[model samples]
Target: MSLAHLVPAAVALVLSAAPAMAQEAPRWSFAIHGGAGVIERESLTAEQDAAYRAALKQALDAGSAVLASGGAALDAVQAAIQVMEDDPLFNAGRGAVFTAAGRNELDAAVMNGTDLTAGAVAGLTTTRHPIAAARAVMERSPHVMLIGQGADSFAASVGLEQVDPSFFFTERRWQGLERALRQQNLPIPERPAGAPGPQAANDLPAPPLNERKFGTVGAVALDAQGRLAAGTSTGGMTAKRWGRVGDVPVIGAGTYASNRDGCAVSATGDGEYYIRASVARDICSRIHAGASGQIAGQAEVDDALSLGGSGGVIVMDLQGQPAFAMTTSGMYRGAVSSSEPARVAIYGDEVLRP
Candidate 1:
């Protein structure tokens, strides 16, 4: 064949390959929150700020590794949350706040969007990783939620890690508990016997009220296979009493995902108000009803704000896009996607990319 004829044939061949190349690209994406509330620059020292950012980055890396390998969205979300849950920097597991009874009662939920199956555990005091316990509930039990002693029992039955409640102790959280109870004119309960005794003065006596008002850790992810999953873990409110439960263990409240809706949402903040607004489910619902994820996130959070809720939500769509909305001054949040680098920001004025 002549050189001109060969060139035309090659051009057509390259054009045909373009579609296949595009299809081969991974569509994975992920986002996480270490909680959302009135965080101020003045509240954290330079060192403390760096530590928080590092912790968030670690969580992003954990999830990103899973998604990059074409893992299930549920696994990616769980992996990200487990990192934060083990870190004392976040308010979920190790650093969980104390209750009025001087105990750490955790709550968590996991949702598989592909089938809409979900599992949750509330007021669980011994599970080392509540997110894992939540997943166990979904996979091993017929129920959607298990709580308190029952949840703890179920978790152990499923071979989930069980720890002494003291494993959750952190001086900062203890200080926060003392301050919260003092503000309420309540007596301080004795710390658990097995927990380590207080040592240094490195802890904040009482963080700002806004910061104390809310704390949680959560994640939402879209996997390479286009599945969506979400999970949220929380220490609940400081000084909560009489077996209190929050939105974290409530599917469609603090965490919701739906493949049919093409979205997954995870929320952090004032659980009471979030439950009322149905923030997580509401955001995905609006998207299913034709609203964009960004629009849905902000609008639903606005509704929660109207009712005096202060918190934030992270939303991820099937296309590997993420959206965030918060009524509070700041949220410890971050995102990673095929098209975006891992980035985190604490303040609302910060660029949305991180």
Candidate 2:
């Protein structure tokens, strides 16, 4: 063969190998949040701060390990959130706050970006892992959400593990509830208030209530196939009453994922404001409209703050870019990507690099 023929063969060989190299080096990333609120450095003890950092790093490692091993984004998100759910440090799953009646009711949701399908469970009292039940609702049941006894029933029928309600009890959450009730000057209820009929044993506090700690947990990820997924879980606000449900189980409010838009988001904050703003979906929409992940996230959060909402969000784009923004004092957040080292931050001053 002449030199010209040899040159053409070499170029063809290089072209054939390029796609394989790209496929093997898939860009993936993961991010998670324990919650967002008035987390002040002066308020937290060194021991408490260390514990939270360690837990955040552990969750980041769990999810990133899944992505590093070529797992699906949905799996990575679920895995990371499950860790937070199981940890008593966050206001989800095992550490859920108590209702006015001092009972634990949990809520969770999960979304798949590939199809935009979602599942959620709300007001669950006995399910072991509400996030897993949410996934079951997405994968097995035909419904997008299940609540209260119905949700618990569906979770049991689906073979999800059930635990005694005591499993969710934690001293810190109990104290929070007590403090909220004291602040409102309302007596602790002997039982959860029933549907409106007659006055309850204790009068419910009026609206314009004091701010309570919102400890919702969430995770978002972009996987090897460039797919996105998001999940969120919470025990709702301390001293929540009347079987209240939050954005944690509301699609597009607390959780959103869109491969088409190249974004996935999970939010933690005031559930009502988040739902009103459609914060998670709005972030994805902004990103689709050509804003970078950081810009989109911060913009949506700014809007929420304008409406008197307080909280934080963690977002991941298809390009493996991650951003976390909050209107509150701080957010318990962390992230990891194929191109960057793991990072965790609590205060606004602790900036995370891309």
Cα RMSD to native, each candidate?
11.0, 12.6
lDDT of 2 by residue, 1-354 (tens): 111222232233223222243443338888889888777787577877888888899999999999999999989888988899888888899878888888989999999999999999999998989999999999998899999989999999989899878777665666567778998898875433332223321221211222365778999998888889999999998888898888889999889998898899999888888899999999999999999777678778778656775777888887776777776667788888786667787766566432
Clashing residue pairs found in predicted model 1: none
For model 2, state the Cα shift of residue 75 in Å: 0.6
Name the best candidate (by TM-score): 1
Give the TM-scores of the predictions, in the order they appear.
Answer: 0.90, 0.86
Report lDDT (CA) for all predictions: 0.82, 0.80
List ranges where model 2 is wrong by over 4 Å.
1-26, 189-211
- Pairs of colliding residues, candidate 2: none
- By summed lDDT, the worst window of 10 consecutive residues in model 1 runs over 1-10
Q: How far is candidate 2 from the true structure (C-alpha RMSD, Å)?
A: 12.6
In angstroms, the error of model 1 at 260 is 0.9
Best by lDDT: 1
